[model samples]
Target: MAATLTRPKLDVKSLDPYTFLAVIGKRVIHPGGRRSTEELFSLAALQAGQKALDVGCGVATTAIQMARRFRVAVTAVDISPLMLERARSNVRRAGLERDIEVEQGDILGLRFPDGRFDRVIAEAVTMFVDRQRAARELVRVCRPGGMVLATEFFWRQPPTDEAREIFLGQVCPGMQLDQLDGWVRIYQDAGLSAIEVRSGPFEMMTPRGFLQDEGLVNAFACMVRGLSHAAYVRKMAWLMPRISRAVPYLGYILVRGVKPAAR
Candidate 1:
């Protein structure tokens, strides 16, 4: 089969409110689902004794798991103080307070000494940052010859302009999706050599599963009864149904790049 390239046409800013709610909601409902955490660690190829950083570490699930399961020291950071607090609690609950460091910070402007981490892993974070700036930050904190692992959701094929707008503009705004080539280009431009990217299927559970049930149809019926578009809340209320439907068609792409060992 021929390889297909995808380009996401969504303005990434509109997606923030939804992303924030959705992330916090996930932790509230699931408290770290097994499938997602399992997939993250397996794909990251985490090893023992390696110093790792989990950027955008929502609830610190993967970071804590890495320390406990792999015996690696991890520093997990996120932009949200609420999420950071949850992560800290989770880390302490797991008796990993000595193994993982929880911090509150933005991925674009990380506060770490140069070449501090042997590995950096981010799941679903780059789309939220200025692409080039995010990439440079990831590489900057990683030691020379270390690895950066990122897994992001992308459309298997580009959506039609109408679908794109409904999915991005009216629905989930400010979210960026980069195809395989785009990721390679960004990593290369950021001075990461030996870039290796692999695309894979994601087994989504919560939202995707919930969207498929009869519950969604019933909820939509209730939503359409008195919905308006005058306010941001109204806008999202209208967009949520459409956005939910678009989830099944998306795929998660994993990209791994290495900082050069030496000149």
Candidate 2:
């Protein structure tokens, strides 16, 4: 008799609405777009010979970009195996296998040695994990005097009930979403010094955003996916206006700090 083969079950708990966007081949899932990533990297002041780490690097888009744009070597890590697979594929496609390394990892507790990287970047993540712990980990892995930056979904102000229901409940479940000041506070509490923060709108699902992030071809693919995938299509049907209504209070923040230099 032939034995029955079993495939591993998909980890739905790891998924959020963003996973739907990724499934449809959308690479730029960051809050603002590609420009936002460039801005963050520029602010990080990444340079050649710098060793960087991208924590929770979904699909490794930023990792590849930083390696190519700044001539830096990056170790990209994500908790989700599915994301790591896609990220590895993207890295290979970019011909950046030499410059970028992909690893499966947990953000709350990383395996790298202390003071390992020149730059540590956690983008659009940490909202789901313990912000304080994640920040500490990021700073821990970063060399003293190195830059550590995290970009997360930030409430422009306190969330109204309806907005909370949509953002915290629907958009990002089981997440610890915070307001602008609250996000900044996480780094302060983590003992990072020389903190700098920048805020902007989360117009990521809009047309202009698509162009800015994915460009013409991939944006077209995303549009097609929005039409073809039932779940994504339904998500879009419900998401746009709901987020639009909440736009005034919804946005993202880029918070950067220097790991205090040794005395």
Candidate closest to the true structure, highest TM-score: 2
Candidate 2 versus the native: TM-score? 0.91
- The C-alpha RMSD of each candidate to the native structure, in angstroms, is 10.4, 4.3
- Candidate 2 clash pair list: none
Give candidate 1 regions above 4 Å deviation. Answer: 1-40, 201-240
* Poorly placed runs, candidate 2 (over 4 Å): 1-15
Residue-level lDDT of model 2, residues 1-263, one tens digit each, is 11211121333234466776776688988786776686788789988999999998988999998999899999999998778999999999999999999998999999999999999998888888887898889999999999998888877877789988887777666888787788888998887889998888877776787787888999988787567634556667777776676667777789889999888
1-263 in candidate 1: lDDT tens per residue? 12211212333234454343333233311212344445556656778999999998877767876898899999999897767877888889999999999988888889998789999988778876787899899999999988887777677677667667776676546777766687778878988877666665433434543343215663355334223212334445655566555655556766678888776
Go through the candidates in order and give each one's C-alpha lDDT.
0.67, 0.83
Taking all chains together, each candidate's TM-score versus the true structure is: 0.74, 0.91
lDDT of candidate 1 at residue 28, scale 0 to 100: 19
Cα displacement (Å) at residue 164, model 1: 1.3
lDDT of 1 at 201: 43
* 162: Cα error in model 2, Å: 0.9
